[model samples]
Target: MKTEDLITRLAAEAPATAPISGGRVVMAGLLAGLPALALLLGLLGVRPDFMAAMAVPVTTLKMVLPAAIALLAGGAALRLMRPEGRVGLAGPALAGLALVALALVVWRLVALSAPQIPVALMGRTAPQCLFLLLGLATGPFLAVFWGLRAGASTRPALTGGLAGLAAGGAAATLYALHCPEDDPLFFVFWYGGAILLSGLAGMVAGARGLRW
Candidate 1:
């Protein structure tokens, strides 16, 4: 075939543009995940003391930190969906979160006795926190993976991992309502662990699912 004829045929067959942006996809995933998360919360029931506890800075921060992480990670994931986009401020955001957690720990520790330290660090739900967060995060993670699947991400695994981080962070925000453990140390550890685990899972999923 002549070169001109071949070009015309290829152009005719080219796909049309997508209807949505990466941000919209991420938002869809988040929205889709919300119902399941709400059900989980309803089933688990919010802490009886949550309303009164929210008055405390530490308790409030428990909700705020994960929400902040979700926002940052969502922004990163959206950027990562583009073939050439980078992770921009997400790294610094996470680092800042860690520093804040560290400061909270230091502040709390200065006021507590040695005997109370262990009890504070290992709240009654310490053993269950990671597992609960992971379970809560699963639906959101899957939804995020679905949302990102059609993206032309150069680093699929990394993008997926960031999506997982976003999902886990959202889950943690929901979980905080039900979690009575107000210790910063516990939040920093178990909640962080759960988010990390979800990120790893996303990495693996992205490697497999996001492959073009």
Candidate 2:
């Protein structure tokens, strides 16, 4: 067949409706998750010193770190939705930030009095951090997965996992406002672990659900 004739024939058969864009899908997921997060935050209440804490670098970093992770992961997820897309630097970027956080914690702990080490590592809310983060992330996870369902991701598992990271990271950012645990150690262990767990869940769900 002539190339021009074939092209014309294929174009005529194309579906009239345009597929939803990745940005729109992710935006919808984010919107879907917002109400749930806001409601949860309302119930839990923001820290009394939230405004004051914002001036502190340590306090600010807690939210900054997760926000960065969410941006990177969400960007990656959007890219991965395209069949030819690659993860690029998102994974490494997350690892680097995590390492920086860990190093800071270790340095701070080393300089602390031996007795302070325990207290710093085990902040008052350490136990609650894990559950709270995961709980808050639940809505986003479901929302993002629903968004992923509309995408034709070649790397479904990876895309889902990134989406999970985005969701968890976002939840953590908001949770940081209410979380009184300012110690880096607490963040590195609990906050980081929770985000990882969310990614793992996404991986499993994507592997099972993102198939064509």
Candidate 3:
């Protein structure tokens, strides 16, 4: 067979529908996890005083920080889905946001007396926060990863890590409504730890599965 004819035949055989965009894939992933996250929230029950707590800047900041991270990281993940896409400002933006969080944590730490430091850091729900944040993020991560599988990503680990961090951050934001731990020290360390853990898992998975 002539090479031109063979190429034409293969092109004709391609699927008629256009593949979904990375933004759509990320949105779909969020939708996919909504029901599960809702169920988890229902089971845990939102803290009765969430509204009041939200009115407090310090307490509400816990939610805002994670939501911001999710937004930025999710955008970065989509950008990386394209072979030609560069991370651009996403890396430095993420770093600056993280630094802001750490600075808040440090400020909170200093505000506490020496004896109160340990209790504030540990919080009553430290372990539960970690487990629930990771668990809630699982479905989103899997959905995002599955959706991105067909993309010609040149930076798989970064793509997957951002997706994972996005998933974890979103879940953590929702989880905050249910979580009683409002201290910057506690959530910054434990909640941030959970998000990073998700990013690590995605990095490993991307290394194995996202390679073309």
Q: State the TM-score for model 2.
A: 0.87
Cα lDDT of model 2 by residue, 137-182, tens digit = 8887887788778777898888889888888898899888789888
Highest-scoring model, lDDT: 3
How far does residue 166 in candidate 1 sit from its true spot (Å)? 0.4
lDDT of 1 at 140: 73
The Cα RMSD of model 2 versus the native structure comes to 3.5
Write candidate 3's Cα lDDT for 1-212 as tens digits.
Answer: 99999999999998887865976787788888898778877798889998998999888878998898898998888877889878789889999989998898889877999999999999898888898889889999999999888787899988888888999889889899799988899999988999999999988888888889
Output the lDDT of residue 84, model 3: 88
- Regions more than 4 Å wrong, model 2: 1-14
Q: Model 1, 1-212: lDDT tens per residue?
A: 99999999999999987654876676777677777677767788888999899999777988898889888987898887778789987889888997897798888789889999898988999877888788888877887788777777888888888888888898899899899898787787778788888888998998888878
Q: State the number of backbone clashes in model 2.
A: 0
Model 3 poorest 10 in a row by lDDT: 17-26
List per-prediction Cα lDDT, in the order shown: 0.84, 0.84, 0.88
Instruction: Give the TM-score (vs. native) of candidate 1.
Output: 0.87
Candidate 3, lDDT over the whole model:
0.88
For model 3, what is the error of residue 139's alpha carbon versus the real structure, in angstroms, after optimal superposition? 0.5
